[model samples]
Target: ADMPGISKDRLNVKVEGDTLTIEGDAEIPMPEGMEPLYADVRATHYQRSFTLSSEMDTEKVEASLKHGVLTLHIPKREEHKPRKIEVQVD
Candidate 1:
């Protein structure tokens, strides 16, 4: 996710059952000792939700935010992973 201007401290990520939620607050700070006469950008709240599949391992999900980009790594369950079987010569 491209979340420019949002700090990591103001971001929240949570997973409940099959639901995954992401919330954050975006605020434009004013320069010190300067008052804004008119501001085009203002503070805003952002939220997004997603439903995870059973094949995904929720417990092993990983999240990281850097350079205003949020990244999520969701790995497949053990049973869902591809397996190789070798056949024995009868």
Candidate 2:
């Protein structure tokens, strides 16, 4: 979810079964007449994945990108959420 300086056009997300995958690539263009001898920034490509649990509601999962930051939301299903069981004594 910490996808800073990444654009939506360069981002790819996929979920299969219980696995979630995220991939992206970024390349900054340089001027033809200007070149830096010492540069710490360069083109980058990344891939990450995580195994989701059965409690996650994959159908309702959502994602949003803002200010180069990506956020993913995976809420627990109603049936999977913790609930207080009622006590009845006969």
Candidate 3:
């Protein structure tokens, strides 16, 4: 996710059952001793939810945030991974 201007500490990721939820707050702070008289940008709250497939392993999900970008890695279940099949010729 391209979440520019959002701090990692202000982000939250959670998975429950088949639902995945992401929540965060975005705020722009003003300089010390400076007050905003006519500001166009305001604080914002963001939340997104997704339904995970049965083949996805929620227990092994990994999340990382760097340079204002959020990344999620979800591996498929062991049984759902592709396997090579051997052919026997008689």
Candidate 4:
């Protein structure tokens, strides 16, 4: 789940030593006229971490943000990808 007003600039994604971290912050604007009686929101900061193995190609990663949504693409290495293996029988 993600907040409505989060942008790409506020997000930080990085991968290091088999660890992937995704973090960001959201700003909440104070409503005009009337103040909130109680405010308890996770909109201030967000963080997520993932453990990656050797199969993940960390060097070649892609990320895109559209309409306040973040998308990340992590592709597998050529050796890790699915391929055909031939067997010889004599």
Among all windows of ten consecutive residues in candidate 3, which has the lowest summed lDDT? 38-47
Measured with C-alpha atoms, the lDDT of residue 42 in candidate 3 is: 55
Across residues 42-77, which tens digit of lDDT does each residue of candidate 3 receive?
A: 546778999999999999999999987899999999
For each candidate in the order shown, give its overall lDDT on alpha carbons: 0.89, 0.83, 0.88, 0.80
Candidate 1 lDDT: 0.89
Query: Model 3: what TM-score?
Result: 0.85
Q: After superposition, how far is residue 65 of candidate 4 from its true place, in Å?
A: 1.4
Q: TM-score: which is higher, 3 or 4?
A: 3
TM-scores for every predicted model: 0.85, 0.79, 0.85, 0.76
Encode model 4's per-residue lDDT on 1-90: one tens digit a residue: 354456777888899989988888886678688787787674578888999879989999788877767788999988999998899999
TM-score of 4: 0.76
Instruction: Name the TM-score of candidate 2.
Output: 0.79
Which of 3 and 4 is the better model by lDDT?
Answer: 3
lDDT of 1 by residue, 1-90 (tens): 877778989999999999999999886787799988886555478899999999999999899999889999999999999999999998
Better of 2 and 4 by lDDT: 2
